[model samples]
Target: MGDGHSQVAQKDKYVAIIDQDKVTDEVRNIALRYDPLNRAGRREGFHVTENGELHIDDEAVIEEHKIVANRIPNDAIKIVRLPAERGELVHQYGENGFRLYELPAPVKGTVGLLGRNGIGKSTALRILGGTLKPNLGAVSDEPDWDTVIREFRGTAVQNYLEKLRDGGVSTAYKPQQVDRIPDRYDGTVRELLIVRDERNLRDKAIERLNLEHIADAFVDDISGGELQRVAIAATLVADVDAYLLDEPSSYLDVGQRLSVARTLEEFVEDKMVLVVDHDLVTLDVVSDDFHAFFGDPAGFGVVSRPLSARRGINQFLEGNLRDENVRIRDTPIDFLRPSARQEMDGIPILEFPALTKKFQSFSLGVESGTIFGKEILGIFGRNGLGKTTFAKLLAGALEPDEGRVDADINISYKPQYLDSSFDGTVVELFAGQVDVYTRAFETEIQQPFDLEPLFDLVVGELSGGELQRVSIALALARDADIYLLDEPSAYLDVEQRMSFAATLRQFVNRNGAPCLIIDHDLLLLDYVSDRAMVFEGESGVSGVGRSPQSVRKGINRFLKIVDVTFRKDPNTGRPRANKPGSQKDREQKASGNYYAV
Candidate 1:
């Protein structure tokens, strides 16, 4: 067996060398296609060996080929590693808590710390940022944070400055929650640019990020997604070597997410950028390295391959299931059942008659049978489309100017901006409201959704998924006949999104309630929704309603323009598209965009 293994290893080495030669030849051919002037230079080094192999020694080509060999270890930076301790209290009630179990050397470039709700990912980040100190674990390198900083000031002063100047190391943290700007101090987005010492570079940053429209808007009233972008903009304006962004894409939609990923890629070209996000799709595209924090006391974490990031995250959330390979199911979901349609009583819960929404120049109509009990409705459109506006109109937050909105039934609306809407603990949001629906549903809400541990926890401290669950609980706790959930599953991870869908299904099945969910996650939409609405056109006002299968077909047809193919998810059976080639395959797979049929 050892001999056979040795032979296989030898063969693998030869194959690798052969592959490298092939790649070199391909690179030369492609370079020659565009740079005709370099042909003579390339010919100087071009040769065919006795084995009939092409070789090139062009200086530029050789330099380009040396990129892999020239790669520097980014993990060389001296990180203050902490020794792992048992059950150390990182936080003592109300304050942020973290306990480091194994402080792996900073070999992985820009580690991403991901975990389930309340698992202390944010707390761990704060500890690394020097904002919070773990009560239990000690730094592996003798001196504590203060001592390290002082030591840097004392002996390593020149080295630290040199590192900073050479862009060898720097770290900045952007919190998941946006803090309130001082009311007395009014400032435009451009003014906030000055805070980061980018007053002169404001236009460059804005143009790069495409934030011209909201450049003058007050920092206070921008949309949640826009606010998130602004926060990122503030960080990008600063010249840093590393950035720790917590849930940067929490409020962004599909388009904005793509834009943000592009921006981060540019940023990471010269510096390490660690973005802790719940959206697996964005992470797959943006991250070069991935890390996950799991287990009790939340100390255990594993640095995983980038390709397996999504699977690792899912496994962490759901536990190691038997079918590990099948991460997502692609089965088409039935949003509404026959029984649900029969129980509608012929009265429309809410109808938008030629609903022409403001800010978005489009119109549509929704009838009674269109949305039935316990049905998940996916409202999809391009960004700047009136999806949010339409949601606001349904929620009674905005009055329609032209069309009649017949929301004759009791409705509970969970808006997109959950942070500003509610203030208090998770318990407080549903405490008084739970009893009101208990008698109606004939089942105690607390029993179905366990609100005990979450009673005292502040709402503001909750993760996006936790807050989303809380929002759903609060909405479900109410005795409303209809639910208008705007981007209900926006910030939730794969597990949370699925769990929320099940909860929504239960709400409809148990209490005969209906819901309209505006979301960008097509997979979730396929699973939970009974009907799909696709809003098209540049303004995204007009929409076409169709079945899940039909919608998949339409999406596939549209995505074909980009040379991508949509396939059924093996786990859930939802439709998903993927780009051609292994690079795009790895990216799409890592992103968790693979849908179920």
Candidate 2:
């Protein structure tokens, strides 16, 4: 109190929480008690003193309130001790960042790792797979698994590691980046899978992964999705006691994703399996239980105990671990009711006539539609249904065979295929494209998109999620009448997707610009879209894109095509895919409400 003045009688402990934005009279008095010379005649707008004093300057620009760093002496502040941990694997990064991965010693069945990206999921997987040995929180010359096992002496993970050390257990791992397979192996799909086919299940694995069409294709020539499937199939064909898969649904479609999940469950039902994925729905469907990872992304993390599939997802959405009494995230992710008011009756910004485009073996036709002002149009369909083709047509990258978008509009588009070939850093990229230093850009684009941390990093070196955030931020930074984002949710985690959806919706409302987002994330579409567009018909051969309609109706139509019914969770309002013949599913199907509220 009184700016730490000893004359005012210094106490052993004191804490004063001040509102940084609106400095109160009492707070100003406290500041003056320390520095009586602090005054108001500093500049245009406000004078923010280095000593945490605020002065009224009419011509000064008001700075946004930020969290102030603690600068008191070490003896002045009390330290809150964290609970002690005796985990199987403990890895440290920098001085304070580390991961306390607490897993069952001898992992059983299929347990999943759920969390935001860069929070130590991959590290945990690698440590378990014997690729990276655990150090047990030490910086010694040799980090040994023996010490790690000793730390978990009375734990199941210790037993698991002991068996592994004795060569009694084996493991097969599938890394997150499937494209890297081409870097290590130049062989064909069949060759890759058969090499790891110690169980003689290569043929079944290929069939299950839908690799029959590209069975003989070289790894270098196949698509991203194809590479992912091949990688999974290769690992599945191995005769290992445990399997570790990271982001198995990265580039897959709905049907392909389901098929892969089913195959994984069937092949490794009796073995120990651990998966790390961001798609909540797919994770819910595939995993029997979950180990939720919590803490600062890319900095520190703690893996929690096992939670049932349904409970895990719901708790993640709620941003809290009920059992541990730990809050992983700031706010709960809750969705507004479908019947809530949205920008439904806004004026039309762009009108398109029935459009058609044809390629060598595929053709796409879209029914006429109008995108309302300040509204987001959600596009849903499986892969190869010409979604990208449709986007390019609207972007004027391709000519329609029949009709056209017809409207004269400036568009900001983030394409499905991102070219990470930039030779400059993220800061330089933003400098050459948008004014990243401005307040508006910092608030609306940089902060919400979490692009600040990647500013100094080279564009080409960024990961999938990092690259995606950059591409999307660039798109949003530009001045355009219409925003076209194809699969914007592709590489983003669940939290990132929801954050972007909220930001995009706010941007639309503020700028009065309509946006069309084509993505496969149902919860994202449900959260961001004011209306929806359903694309149907045969994949890769013939496709149809229907006109935009109400969000409920459009989603219902699309889900009907997929033959899956979704109902909102009562607690969080997030979509939960119903069981095949569950009461909710049966009721929704009978009532013809696939996207039930």
Candidate 3:
């Protein structure tokens, strides 16, 4: 969009551009002649014959681009690129930006935007939703529609933009913060949803999302998960050309996340759909192709060209962008297997008998479990299944109705939701906390979380991810035999979640302190725990936590109940959710093995 005239000169070196409409027959023939299934090394040269036939010596490059192009459905509307400038801030509100990347919108399958937070993903989606007109690098002046149309001429996006500029297209956007919906609306969920039902899809959406019971409930009374479903339902009911959802997986359990993905893939097949999610497994399951965002968060954001889902995600985990010739991270994030459980020769750090906690309409029964000095226990359960209730009982924040935690042992607890009530900077809040300032903690917590730059920021003004990191550090820095962290990975991006998991494992192993972590992220749990506890029962009415078992056993038990299965990715060995009713899912279910091998 910057000055039009094919400003892709900088990226031309690594990228091979071919106009699909203008390509010669010979060029097309050569591309089709190559065996798509061949696995041979490709050469590296670009050549053009005198007859205007284009050729690339590198078969791998041709194959890669071919796969991407092939994946784009024949009915794709347009390819969009949002570029960012680096080296200096564009204005008082902008930072150095990343380079140009492309987002192709297919009329059918979803195209995911994956990256760390604050990488202009939301901005791009806003442009697509028509909520924000892209300045297209001309922030100082008004957007020029004529130049923008000319730049993307001969593509589906050009015609789309022309219609958009002329007020012909409509879009429905589900924003990232579903938790904030209550603040903007005051009505029953049904009322809020039905009012937006231009397409008469309210009933269908509600049934698909399992929101029948809460249809008449006030928006203010619903939980975060409920709010998310309601928000998605509203988006679905609206008649729009594009359906954009930002972080639909947040506040949802693994099962619910899958449900949402299925609903979108089923009902929104004919329309353009775009989604942004940090849960790697969810993103992989929901998207056909992905556009990866890379660059310094809050500094500069760059979008990568589209690639097949598996390849793009693998590249992201590898921290390398081969086509862009950039390494976004210092090192690749590995999904390494957890170490074997340590033989606990020492005495148990804490042991609790069967515990019961009852609230107004909810009750939790925790089966007896023991934690050794060298063990970290992971808690897996759906929302309202009393995982947090068990954690609170362990931390003495709540007294169990009928059982007791060891009164003599010390425990530190980080709650599920964070509170930013501190009236000073982050450093000031931890001024006398010696461990936080020590070299060991700095290396383990500060460096990995990138907290050094956030130390001077006001505690009340910190972002969700920042506050989570601070809360984790505070809990770890305290002198305690056991730690209880509830939803510590909430709001953290994939990179931060991976880093935090590593840090937590190191702290638990190094200090020989036991930890009980309750979270919904399966990947983080797999990476950090030696054993897991599965909670089962009615979500709100009653929940029963089973005794701690091996990680695989617990995961298998839980996933079996939820009717889902995981398979290991051949490239990264990461856990990936199998499509429901797929061959792998059927095979695993038949064999009574839900966890990946």
Number of the predicted model whose TM-score against the real structure is largest: 2
**Candidate order by decreasing TM-score:** 2, 3, 1
Each prediction's TM-score versus the true structure: 0.65, 0.82, 0.79
User: In model 1, what is the error at residue 427, expressed in angstroms?
Assistant: 4.0
**Candidate 3 residues 273-335, lDDT tens each?**
888888887788888878788765654466676788888998999998777666778799785
lDDT per residue for candidate 1 within 35-91, as digits (tens), equals 333444545333445655443321223323323322212211111112122112223
Q: Quote the positional error of residue 281 for candidate 3 in Å.
A: 1.5
Scored by lDDT, model 1 comes in at 0.51
Query: How displaced is residue 34 in candidate 2, in Å?
Result: 17
With candidate 2 superimposed using the best TM-score fit, by how many Å does residue 499's alpha carbon deviate from the native?
1.2
Candidate 2 lDDT tens digits, 1-597: 012211212222111222343355444554333321234442332234676655432111122211111322111111111233312336754222344445533367788788888777888887788766666556435556676666665555767778777788889998876766787899999988878899899999988887887898899877677888898998998998999998888767666777887898788868999888988778888888788887656545678777888888889878888887767777886644442437578888888899998887788989998888898888988766788788888888888999967558888889876667789999999899878779999888888887866887899888878988999999989989889998788767777887788898889889898989988777778777888888899765789999888777877887888778888777676677787789989999999999776
